[model samples]
Structure formats: structure tokens, C-alpha cells
Target: MATLLAGMGVVAVTNAEAAAGCKVVYSVPSQWQGGFTGNVAVTNLGDPVSGWRLTWAFPSGQTVTQAWNATVTTSGSQVTATNASYNANIATNGTVSFGFNGSWTGSNTAPTSFALNGVTCTGGTATTTTTTTTTPPPTDDAMAATAAMQPGWNLGNSLDATGSDETSWGNPRVTAALLDNIRAQGFNSIRIPVTWGQHQGPAPGYTIDPAYMARVKEVVDWALADGFYVMVNIHHDSWQWIANMPADRAGVLARYNAAWTQIATTFRDSSPKLVLESVNEPQFSNSSGAAQNAELLHELNTSFHGIVRRSGGANATRLLVLPTLHTSADQARIDELTTTLTALKDPRIIATVHFYGYWPFSVNVAGGTRFDAVAQKDLTDSFDRVHDSLVAKGIPVIIGEYGLLGFDRHTGTIQQGEKLKFFEFLGHYARAKKITTMLWDNGQHFGRTSFQWSDPELFAQIKSSWTTRSGTASSDQVFSARSSAITDKSLTLNLNGTSFLGLRHGTTDLVRGTDYTVTGDQLTITASAITRLSGSRAYGTNATLSARFSQGVPWRINLITHDTPVLQNATGTTSAFAIPTAFRGDQLATMEAKYADGSNAGPHNWTSYKEFDRAFAPNYTTNVTTLTSDFFAEVADGARVTLTFHYWSGAKVTYHVTRTGTSVTGTTS
Candidate 1:
């Protein structure tokens, strides 16, 4: 009979040396290669742990070449090992639980003695009081939970160079603790990615340096401790993935399996608190070779499912999200996708897509035309298309990227209130449609963890932005509130706590008092002409885009290509425009950004810079001179755009542009 030998202060039971490192338990009747395992329990009745090292010596040659949550290092049949980051930290009182798919070659007998961390717990001690194994997966209702945490946290910014720098641990935050500030300021998730090889040793290939992984684990652990869902993935590992495509068609699956064997094993046993994205925006734009690469990607993802299911720890059934060929929701509907879709033996597989409807506008990758009246509609149209398709397939969708830039020299500028309104509305739309959303946030610039999106002005406005459906019960109102976008149009767009309404050249089309239509993440304002500013002689041209979005994605404005750079002359700004030694004939200006996940989005070459470079003709605009910090010009005849750039934090340079279409030389500082 089992009895409790209770003691005061702490239980000093006999042979207490075998403290459980993992504390999860499970009872599953499954057969290993040699025998059957009906129940298992793993516990971490210890201290701070990055992971664990467990070794089960075997008399026969039954080796563990493949495993998850735990890594294996063998020498001459004497096996030794440990757990990956996810399982390593057997918190003082916390525990992990999981089962493995193993095989047996001969007779077996349960060991009578067990020792953990060099302390031995003799047989016949206390077995009934130990914790079990297994991490419970997230349920579909997860969307409702995060939505309820903090309502107006839908919009986000990508913290490029001026925003953040990479840390040794693959975290983009200038430091690792920023996530707490982000959470306190009201954000819910962080997407920290590592360009694996970029910061890791071993140049540009396999073998993820231990130091890099160690650093990454530290940051990820920090995020989880703060209670935010963390997304860690393999980012621009350069050609680590592209160069290592499966040579033999079948081997593709094998390699994919092996890669995950390492990844899952690394973090599999942690709490069921993080999301593991299979890959980032996989791309190969060069040629027909793109198709071959796409096929390989699908094969890799297919293999990812099995590997994830077999993590062999608490994360065995953890949430696993899969991206499309390039994570494009449109292409994700490819016919062959059905193969992987049907093959989804595990229920945790969530589909992912990147929502950058207004490309140059969202990322400003290339200097394109600034905001247009219909741009917002076009942006949401794409979200609707993807939303409808994913919903029809009965699966949750995730928008990986979306943002608006404040530094476009030609046509890039949106009201602060407008952006916040965009965020609130997007979340409403997504919630109305019952969709889960995660904002891809950069460290700062537009206010990430370091800066507050809901500051003095943005805070009251964000709360006021959401409209409650009157005359309904609390629960129903919340439900209806989620599906509908805020309709108030009189919403003033503020920036850095400054009013933007009176600053524009003309009266904006956005009404002073009217709510826009909201369905899912799509929003449309009923207005004649939303007036926005562009091209201040003191700064560059400013294009005010109407904002729109899909639930689960960042809300953003839209912009088209500009015919000419807004830079008019050179002599007006800091000095006549002269390319820095860093300039390489019209190359796009790019930056590095750190997201909420403690990861960085980088090396982006936006549009306006290149357009300003190749098209500026001095004589047509102002004294045709200087530009830096802000654009300048003489508005006599037709406007001529000129461009000048200044180095700021990193590769990101601030632009000063000036142009005069005719009689219009207002400066934008």
C-alpha cells in the first residue's frame, strides 16, 4: 500500500537523490521497436536548466541515432545524452513529460536504481509521488484567449537598424530583456528568428554553432517566462537550406527529418508555450529553377509533420505552423498542397502566410508611388481572398509580415491615429471572423518594446477606436465587437504624439466624424478625398496611404510607384546632394529590424531611394542643391525631385528630398 511519509518544512524521504528533472506524466499504450511502454513520467525537480542530458546505456547495439527534445552522443555503444533547450530547464518545481518511439532487440528488465544529476536514489523508495510526462497542446479556442488579453495590440513595426541591432544570441533586441517591456506596454507575441549561419560559426552552412543556439535559447526562454507566445525559426541561414536540397528525391524527406530531429530535440520538452514555424519566406525568384525548389520545400514540410509529432517530449503535440512555397496564401492553395494537408496526421499543424498586400508600401522595399485613394481597398482585398480560402479548408491562418514605414523620401507617410485605427480595426475584423492573429513587431522606430504604440496620444485613441455594438449582452457585444471594424472617421492621425490633420497640404478625404466599414481585417472608409501631404521642401515627399488589414496580420496603408523622385535640388539640405562612399549607383537603401519574437528582419532594399537616384534632374526644381534630413525646393514651374541620404544607426539612412511641381515648396520637418 502506498503511504505518505510527510515531514515538516521539506519532505526528507529516503533516497531522495533521484529528484525528477522533468515533471510531466502520461499513460499511452505504445510499442517500442522491441517492447511496449504503457506509462512514463519525466520531472525537473531541480534548478534553472537550459536543457537536459539523459543517457540510457544498452547492452545490445540498439542505438538512438534519431530523437527529439533529447540529443544523443554515442561512443562505442555507450550512449550518453541531454535534452534540447525546450526540455532542459527543469524549473525548480516545473516538470516535463513525453514518450519516445523506440525499438527493442532483446530481453529487458526495469532498472532498480535511478540517479539524476550525479545523485543516486536507491530502489524501493518513493515512486507514487513523482510527476508524469507530456505537454498538452493548445486548443483551437486559443484565438479567443489571446484576443481577450489586450484588445488593441494588433498593429506592429519591424525594428530595422535604426530600430535594433543583432545580439550574440540571435535576438534583434539591443538587449534580451526588451520583451518584458513589450509585454508591459501591451504586445502579446514576439517573432525572434536567427539567420542561423549568419551569427553562428561555420561560415554559411550546416552545423548550427553551439554558442548561437545557446544564446538563442536564453532569449526564447526569457520570452516564454514573460508569458508571450514566441516564434523561433530558421531565418536567412543564407544557403544553409537552399544549398542542401535533398539530392535524391526520397532523401529530401530524410534530410528534412534530420534537421527537425535537431530542432525539435532542442526545444521539444519545454512547455507547450512556443510556436515552431517550419520556415521563413522561402524564395527563388531567378528562374524555372524556382519550381524545383518549391517542390523540395513541400517535401520538406511534409516531413516536418512527422518529425513534429515524434518530438518525444511535452512538445510532441505542440503547435507546429507550416508556410507555403513562399508563404503566399494565394499559392498555398496549390493543388499539391492537398497532399500535405491530407497527410497532416497531427492536429497541431497550423497554416501560415505572409500578408504584405501593398508590397512597396508595407515594407517600402522599392521607392514606389505613395498613397492613393483606392490603395487601402486593394490591400484588404488580398487578405479577404486568403482568409476565405483558409477558412474554407477549415484551418487557422497566420500573417507573418506587415508594416508601414515613416522614412520614404518619395511617397511614404500615414497619420499615427490612422495606423492605430488600422490595428484596432484589423483585430476587430479578425476576431469577428474568429481568426487568430500575431503582429510581426520590430524593436522600435514606430514604438515596439522600447517605444510604446499606446503612448499618451495613441492609448486613448486605441480604446476609443473600438466600437461596442450597443444593445447587446456583454459576451455578445464582445463577440460582435471583434468582427466589426471601427467606423468613426473623424479619427485624427497623430504621430509621436503630434497632430497630423492640419499638417497636410490639403483637406484630407477622411471624414471628421464617420465610422468606416470593417469585415475581418478589411476596412474601407466612405470618403471623397482623403487629403495627405507629400514633398515638403524641408523633407521628402509624403504619401498618406489609407490603411487596411486581415485579422492576424499587421494593419498598413497602400502606395503606388512615383513617376520621379521627390528630390528637387541639392544645395538646400545639409549640402548639395552627393552620394556617400557607401552609395553604389542607385542601390536600394535597406535596414535591419528586430521583431517581437526577438528576431530581426533585414537587409531590406526599399523602393523610393532607387527611384530618387536614377530620376532626379537638378535644374527643374529649387536652387537644385542640398538635401538631408528633409527635402527642399523652389516651386516656380514643374516640380523636380532630388534626393540626399544621411547615415543614421546602421544601413538605414534618413532622406532629405525636395521638389516643386509648380508654386509648392512647403517644407516637411
Candidate 2:
């Protein structure tokens, strides 16, 4: 956007009679990686204003984290800020001021272009200040603990899932085994969303039932014992009372105060690893529009924070999570929540928001399963806004609940692979920004009864992004081999994992530069210096390609191929293997070429391969690639050459091979 020289500021005077005539000065008082704060002073040159809204677009994907002296909201790069009650009026020659905190990726340049009520701003150059060098505020214990919570998971549908009882939600009774499984899955934190409405006594000193409270405590203890940070919140109370319903406002608060007070007091002696979220998503239907609803939520949060602190013991310093209206990521809601919470000056206060961005795509229940660029942008923009609004302000943010809903509700067919990709990216992005994210598990993706996941692939996706372990997408990846294949030049293999860190051949660890090179998810063996086992020949015969990772079990790809090869000299004879239709666009696994005497069988590296591209050609069923191997010494024809194809974790190849002249022919298996 627009940049102003340091210590330089200008005030432009335009035709005062023009209806939209107004001069605005925009400046950045401070900025840091991923966030910045800006000030805008609007001067009325045309006429006095009773109300106003200033709008502008950020050249980069900058988003408003929080604003003061105005109500702020953003759509993509465009920002809209309306006057607060205190700053609504401006007279000709008079000026009003508003400021905001925003976040940006890559660059934090100020927007050079600006508009006031759709009218282009004129005649003012910006002034920049040297980045602040002030020492940051001392982080409280709660803040530090909250910071430790990255990549969280929710015990959804089991505790807070809709129903009269826990089992009513289609999930088995909560057990220690389940909690152990979660902790073992690399999740260091768990958010237990509990619906306490039904478990509490009636009015006039309404009390939470002791039995239900103990049940909650039992589950909580399991989480703590498993070394997981626990966050227990009052969930689904809004459906019963916690809302903007004027008639029930007093009663709702009474019950809310009583429930939190009791729960807080009971866990007052618990370790600091336990956190208390004020309430689940609070619904607002106040007649006073967004402003009033925000005020109502502000009051609710303030009351909740106060009650918890007053509950005593560890409660005073315990981390507390607060949610905005409906726990929404809307810019207006974030602005309201940030403005309200910042005033509390409580270091332990964490702002909670739920992410289900671009409902049609992220949570599409109408059979939509694609997660393309548009969906990615939705996630990027959502995280950016919250970062600018709260995280930049030193307030830790917790994505209380986030997930791509059932891929196809009617049929069991879900775009599981794509969904796993989304999870991987979400966790990766969240970890980078220091934003803690919890996956919403409701006995759908995971089977509580069997204590197994319906899709282990999906579980692996989230596990690979965890921060507790050295493993993550940014550094290392862990996954089982899907398929193995051998080309003439090098060994080609496909994996369920996206990134490559290191590889091994069975027990022998292979070096990166010397052994293999990785591109995206494919790993290609480089040097032929791999030493063979005692029983194997010079090259790996009947060998397996294993990988070493920072976490999880090492993955191995069995390299096998069936095709007759003509014994050629140094120029190795090419053994052609047909690509399967399902793997037309996918990379092939490692392939092995067997010697006619059964003396040796080594991998053949596929140097050149083609991916199926509909744009490149129509009616293309399979993309064929030629594979080569240096293992070809001398072989006899019609000697019953065997080529066994190994598949990836989720890939299956079907093909039959036949020798034609000098080349081997491959057909659909």
C-alpha cells in the first residue's frame, strides 16, 4: 500500500463542497512479523458527519485483528471500520481518529490506496515510525502454558455431543484407554466440551450434580495422567439458556456463574495443566444488532473471568479461554472480543474461536468434497485475521473446534485423502503461527468402540503435524510404504507421507545426498553405493526400501517387478511395465528387476514419467513412464522372468507383462 517517509506527515485540502470530499491520513505506528498496528485519522472536508464507515483494501492478505474508536470487519483484503458510539461525529475541518491491529504474511507494507465511504482519499502522505524496541511484557505462567498447547484435539460428540446422556451421542462410554490412545497419537492437549445443563440442579442456588461433576473429573484425570493439557468448558448450554434471550438473561447468568464457580472450585487444587473455558459458543439474538450482542458477550466474558479468578487456589493463575459471540472468526466479532478482553489486562486470558470457514466448502454437507485453492485461501484469511486481532496482542488463540464435516453424508464415500491433506495443512499452518488447533472428533472419523480410527490415513495426517515430537511436516514425515517399484536409473517409491527426511534400505541407513533425493512426496535413489546384505548380490536383490523419520515406525516399500528382459551389455535393456489406470497421475512405487538365474534382483530407477493431465490430452486412461536400471548385466530370454509389483499404503496396481522383441509389454492385470 502507501508508505510515508519517516517523520513526514501531510494534510491534503480538497474541494470542501464535494459530497465525498474528505482527507484521511493512514500510518503504521508499529509492526512485526505476521502482525502490525495502524492509525487512521479522518478529517471531514465536505460536511459534518453524524455517522461514518471507512473502507480500504490491503495489498497483501492483511487482516484486522482488533480496532479501537471504530467497529471493524474484513472481507478478504478489504477492511471496513465504522465509528464507535464515542467517535461518531465530525464537523468540516474537524477530524476523528481510529486505529487497528492487523496481520500479514510475507510483507507488512501499508496499503498505498485508501477510500473513505467509497470516495478516494486525497492529499496526505503517511509517516512511519522506527519499529518499537520496547521489551515485551513479562509472560505470565498461564500465557506460557497456553503457548505450549499446539495441535489440540477435542473429545467431541462423546462428552458434548448432542443428547441427554454421553452414550446418547452414538459414542461408547468415555474410558481411560481412549484417552491413552489420543495421547499416544501425538496430541498433547484435549478440549473436553461438556454439556452441563442437564447435569445441574434447578434455580435458586442451582448446583451442578456431584455425580456428573465427578464423571467429568474422571475423564479429566485420564487426560492429565496421560500428560495432556486439559481444557474443560461448559458446552451446548446455549441451546438451553446461555444466549441473548432477554427474558432468560438473568437466569442464564445465575446458572452460568453457579456452574463455573462450582467447577472452578472443585478443580481449584488441580495442576495448572488444566484450563477452564468460560462457555461454549454463545448465541446472540439481541434486537440491538451486532453492537449490543457484542456488549452482551463482553459482559458474559468479564463475569466468567472474574468468577474463575475469585474461585481461589490454582484458579487465580490457571489459563482461562474466552469465546466471542458464537465463537465466530468474523472480523466484527473478533474486533469486539479483542477490544473487550484487552481491557481486562489478564495475561491468562485466551480468546477462543471455532473455524468452519466458507461453509459450503469446509463443511459442505451437500456432497462437496474438494479442498482447492479457494478453500485454502479461506483458511489463510481466517488464521491471518485472528493472528492480527489477538495473537499479535499477546493473547493466545485456541481453535476450539475445527474439521471438514462428513465428505458425503448419504454415502460412506468421503474424499478422505483430500480431507487428510486439509488437516495436514491446517496443523502445519497453526503450528507456524503458534495458534493451537483441536480437531473435532465425534466418533465418526475415529471408532470409540474398537479404539481404532476408521481411517488410519487421516490419523496419520494429524499426527505428522504434531509439535510435541520432533516430527512434523516442516521437518520430517512418517508413513508406511504404499507401493514399491524399480526403474532402470533409480528406485522410485510412493508414500502416504508428503515430505521426505531420510531413507534406509532395510537396516542400513542411507544418506540423503549419497543415497536419494526427494521431490514433494516422491523419493528417488541417487548413488548406487548401497551395500547389499550377505545373501544379496552387489545391488539389492529382493530388497525393501525403508525410511527413517523423526516419529512413528519406519516405512518400507517392497521392490518387485515381473517382465522378461533381454540380456544386454552396459546399455541396460529396458523392461517396460504398464502404469495402472488408478495410478495414471500418481508416481509409481519402487520396482525390482530379477535375474534369470535368481542370483540377484535389484531396483530399477524410473528416470522419466508422465502424470495424467486431462488438459494435456483427452481419453488418457494411464500415463506411461519408462524405467531403467543399472543392475542389468546379462540375462537369457524365455527363462520365466518374474516381475512382482508392490503397492503403496493406499495404491493398488493391476497389470500383466509379456515380452515383445527387445521390450517387455505390460497390460491391465
Encode model 2's per-residue lDDT on 1-669: one tens digit a residue.
334632223334346444555667777654544556678888876656667888888887888865655889999988888875434556677777777666678986666656666666654535453332132213255556666666678888777855667998767899886775555454668899899888778887778778888989999987776666899998888766776455567777888888888888889988778889987888765546887787778878888889889888978888889898888887988998888777898877889999865554554322233455677788888899889888877888989888754332311222333454566667767777778888887767666757567765466556655632222221121122222332222433333343344765543456776666766555655424322321232211245555544343234443332222111112113443323233322222333334345433332112111111200111123333333322222223433343433322224332333343455544432
Best by TM-score: 2
lDDT values for all models? 0.41, 0.61
Best by lDDT: 2
Q: Residues 640-667, candidate 1, lDDT per residue (tens digit)?
A: 3322332111123333233333222323
Q: List runs of model 1 lying over 4 Å from the truth.
A: 1-165, 168-176, 199-205, 238-259, 285-293, 331-339, 363-373, 405-425, 445-669
Positional deviation of 210 in candidate 1, in angstroms? 2.4
Angstrom error at residue 189, model 1? 2.6
Cα lDDT over the full model 2: 0.61
Error of 2 at 358 (Å): 3.3
- Over the full model, what C-alpha lDDT does candidate 1 score relative to the true structure? 0.41
